[model samples]
Target: MASEEIQIKTDYITLGQFLKLTNVVESGGMVKLFLSEYPVFVNDSQDQRRGKKLYPGDSISIPEVGTYTVTRENA
Candidate 1:
């Protein structure tokens, strides 16, 4: 599937926050279950940490869900 672009004004964002930002999960409550049930890829590597720091140009991919690409924007 085609990846969705998510622009961030900050330098970095956490995986869990990003999930919620992208509406991947309904709420923060789903983050634990989502992480345990699905595989999360950060820049193509499987990562389990919700606190994973995503920098500019980083991409996150989840199977069965859309990929989110992080882009930096000047504030």
Candidate 2:
């Protein structure tokens, strides 16, 4: 799938937080369940850590959800 760009106000964002920021998962509880249910790819590799750090240029793929690329917005 084509990747979507997600701009962040900070230098980095956690995987779970990024999911929430992108409106992928509604809540932390949902993120936990979602992670267990589907595979999340970080820079093209399977990553299960909710605390995984995502910096600019990082890519995340949530299977059928869609892919997203991280970018630091003007801040």
Candidate 3:
């Protein structure tokens, strides 16, 4: 599957923020509901925590949504 790269300037980003950055959900408040309804995978393992930490090089996949790869932005 095609993977979209998400660039982050910080050391880490939460799963909720990742979802927002990718436009997978409309708002931060919707992250919880989205997680409850959909299966999200982090490094190929199921992850459902909104506060889960995601660092550069982490991979996330959500069935029917899309796959994503975290990357650090050049400073």
Candidate 4:
């Protein structure tokens, strides 16, 4: 089945920080474990780096959590 995409504002967010903001995992260690064990697709490609810098226009897709397109919005 296809997953729905969720848009998230990332005006000044790094990949690690974004994961924390979205509550994907409890901490950086958890995110690292999840990224290694689980499939995290970025723009349809697998992304295993937990500290991969994410900026506006980047998109990430998680199996159970659906997709997230990065957008820059005013804080």
TM-score to native of every candidate shown? 0.91, 0.93, 0.97, 0.74
Worst 10 residues of 3 by lDDT: 17-26
In terms of lDDT, model 4 sits at: 0.71
Window of ten residues with lowest summed lDDT in model 1: 66-75
Give the per-residue lDDT of model 1 (tens digit) for 1-75: 787889888889889889999999989889889999999999999997888999988989998897889998777
lDDT of 3 by residue, 1-75 (tens): 899999999999999999998999999999999999999999999999999999999999999989999999999
3 or 4: which has the higher lDDT? 3
Ranking by lDDT: 3, 2, 1, 4
- The local distance difference test score of each candidate is 0.89, 0.91, 0.96, 0.71
Give candidate 2's TM-score.
0.93
Ranking by TM-score: 3, 2, 1, 4
Candidate 3, residue 40: the lDDT equals: 100
Could you report the Cα RMSD, in angstroms, for every candidate shown? 1.0, 0.9, 0.6, 2.9
Tens-place lDDT per residue, model 2, 20-67, is 998988998788888888999999999988999999999998888999
Off by over 4 Å in 2: none
User: Cα deviation of 14 in candidate 1 (Å)?
Assistant: 0.3
Better of 2 and 4 by lDDT: 2
